[model samples]
Target: MDRQAPRAGFTDVDRESDPRFYIRCLDAQHASAFKQRYKRRTFDLLELRPGQRVLDVGCGTGQDALALAAAVAPDGRVVGLDFSRTMIDEARGRSRGKALPVAFVRGDVHHLAFADDAFDRCRADRTFQHLPEPRQALAEMVRVTAPGGIVLIVEPDHESRLFDSPYPDVSRRFFAFRNSSLRQPGVAHQLYALFKEFGLTEVAVEPLTEIATEYASIAHVAQFEGGMRIAQRYGVVTEEEADAWLAHLAEADRTGRFFHAFTYFITTGRKPA
Candidate 1:
């Protein structure tokens, strides 16, 4: 069977105008749990101090940015930047009533609207996979960060995804479809080398792995329906096969046998002073 080209899901539309699609994916309860699990780890790596300026590129909905704002409170500032105006608006709306010193802006990562060495710290989470020119974005991140500032890049290695489905072939097809949909599905593995290439010092890469045993969490991670839809659309799997695959998962969830796992690379580097 020939695998079909993966259809663009959230990446297909202009997120600036259609932020709902992206918001829906990240607003799920399981998605929050997944984020909480890693946010602390990422923050610890940042070593943020009071009164330092921080920038969160591709700050979707401002969750991390809000957290950073709280960490840098009393005098510090945190700015959340995204290319999608609607996303920025949603982020700002979420910030209402909060006295956090965080600002949301619509801007491109490749051309940050900030002066060189303007921020004490910079980070982008799960953003590079969707970017066609992730290297350029990383360069901009390096450029805007002040000397000795930390730059953290956290991204998932989609090729490392694993699922315990009854139909291994269908699962394989689904994985294939999922990986093909990403702009740089394997960018996480390249973070270390990219940091070195950008002349960053004290580069470190940490792999954060997560396993989802419950249906809700697994569904959020696998994007089960979306993956099957893409597989069916591309002829990677028959509609019947896709249905059967989902049924197997549903049965596993009911039987307390559901399993899914993936790894994300959290790479951090310090800009040379």
Candidate 2:
């Protein structure tokens, strides 16, 4: 397969054809039960302590940051950082009228604004897949964490996406194009190796598969319709073929045989105490 130039959504929300659409998609994802489970688990994995500073990279709308703030209460601070002003604005708005020890900042992940060992713990959820420099980003995540601090991240492996279809070629071409659309869709598969190479101690990784028997449930977060449009626009697949695949999925849903899932990794490692 030839490598196409990245047209991944979420790399730069300002450049997205419809940034509002992306924002809404995020809001929907946050509301989903499956996502909520992972979000809770991430918070638990951090083992957050009161009055310990935390940083949430790529904190869309500040949901996780706000939650973390409550966990690290009294004097602890949670800084939610994202590159998009639009997102920062939304996050600030969402955090308004709250006395939570949280703040939102607009910044790049490759070069974090904080000094070394600035945070007791750091987390980035569903963030690495959109990074153009994932290794550098992970390094930055580690650099800012204090000794004995935890660094946890969760990212999807786009290559692992599955669609049950009789036309294997259709599934192959469409998903390949979809995978190529991300800046680093395969980052999840590389996290374990990167954690070890980066010298993160006590490294542990867990896998989670999000499966949806209903098309809408999966499509809500995957944005498969927009992806199909992009696939058609890029000549990866024809509009008719895309439509047929959609119909196939819908039929499968009706027959109670629909299946679409993708695997993501939850990885955690600690800085040496």
Candidate 3:
């Protein structure tokens, strides 16, 4: 793959039309930590097996894709897709020289470049939230899945992150970001509804929860702080305000007054046999 020319701004205006800005979260090392925290949750939701074909939408660095590749060893295939060229490059590099056979491509999740009923099982982890039209994406996931195949959409419900923190400002700032990104998790409950709306059958919804005790070890906290810094760096937020928010979160953790928890909704449905 050729190196795409970098744009001037941090975020791409095309993100509203294209799924490019999500790479901000995907191309970071912190994503690996978050993936670990939710590994069991995602795997339980997938319920994959050998000789099965899987498609991992918004595969990021392809860690989840690699895991699926291992599950379908020898016979099964796993294809990972991301909209960002940088992420696809990293993903390809990650699977380089690996015995497992996997394919990584730069493509939009909302508009996948595949024929109908192409994959046995389709998954979009933490991808729908970034979508402007999540229901359309959900429908597409089901469309690309073979009949009787499973389509699973997994995401964190930000509303479930209410922690009883001693520092009020910590929760406040966190909630600001959460509230801004509210649309991402808002569709969690609607995923099943969308699945049914798209004529899928045997639909089901599952919830997974995890708690973080320490801030330093907490991936979400780190991600929040880094994102805030990015916003500051890009003039989205003032540096002083970002510093105050960071101080609050750090202080909350140091004083052992921090409490953090996230709930993930895994909604799955199967096409008619």
Candidate 4:
């Protein structure tokens, strides 16, 4: 099956739908060393300690949950929550017979099942952008975390996505259409202010850039061709223009000028004691 979904894939996940496509995109991104560097940074920012319970919201395939479980060893535990049953099942299957201190549950981020001060730390990676109410989700994340506990958020600024191409005008239109499909493509750029609004102290933000030098390296994850198909479908760009943009990207790769980069913001804050 084609790994790319017909539309932007992250905001939807179901067994009757394209679980494989969504999972493939995640796996590809996680497999990249460039992506792994930032993933590790999140771990460091969380400052995982022994015997400190943690919560991972929108925990997709559970790779980060497993790692978090390992980080908080011995008496500590990690709760992985997602809205998709398929994702929960996939997570459970991977964790079966493993000695990791983690559990997967299906839950809504806007209304987390956990109570106040339930966790020593809370985090959501690449989650807020898909949420219609990112503030509510952040409130819940902050509420569950105990005083002095960390609340970390990771998201990409979609407007920051840049692909070196000849058609700059068409590229802007294409990205505009693409960003419109997301619930909040600019969520990453808003976290600092949101944290302040929620009374989270010591707020900090770090911007990391993920650059793809090869067409094949990013096409599967970014859905280069599949996205163009949708763009043309929506009349955001004409067929000839979209095709030309794609061809320009390909030629850039052959000429060693290919460049695709997106900026990810890692924002973290501490709930006041």
The prediction achieving the highest TM-score against the true structure is 4
Candidate 2 per-residue C-alpha lDDT over 60-81 given as tens digits, one digit per residue, 9 for 90 to 100: 8888999999999989999999
TM-score of each: 0.91, 0.93, 0.76, 0.94
lDDT of 1 by residue, 176-267 (tens): 77787678889999989999999999999998888888878656546788768777887888889988998988899999999888888999
> Each model's RMSD to truth, in Å?
2.3, 2.1, 6.6, 3.3
User: Which residue pairs in model 2 clash with each other?
Assistant: 8-181
Instruction: Tell me the lDDT of model 2 at 146.
Output: 95
Candidate 1, residue 148: the lDDT equals 94
Sliding window of 10 residues with minimal summed lDDT for model 2: 1-10
Model 4 pairs in collision? none
How well is each residue in 75-149 modelled by candidate 4, as lDDT tens digits? Answer: 999999998887889889999988989999999999988889999999999988989799899999998999999
Best candidate according to lDDT = 4
CA lDDT of every candidate: 0.85, 0.88, 0.72, 0.88
Q: Pick the winner on TM-score between candidates 2 and 3.
A: 2
Give me the displacement of residue 177 in model 3, in angstroms: 4.8
lDDT of 3 at 193: 76
Q: What's the C-alpha lDDT at position 142 in model 2? A: 95
The C-alpha stretches of model 3 lying farther than 4 A from their native spots are 1-34, 166-174, 181-183, 219-252
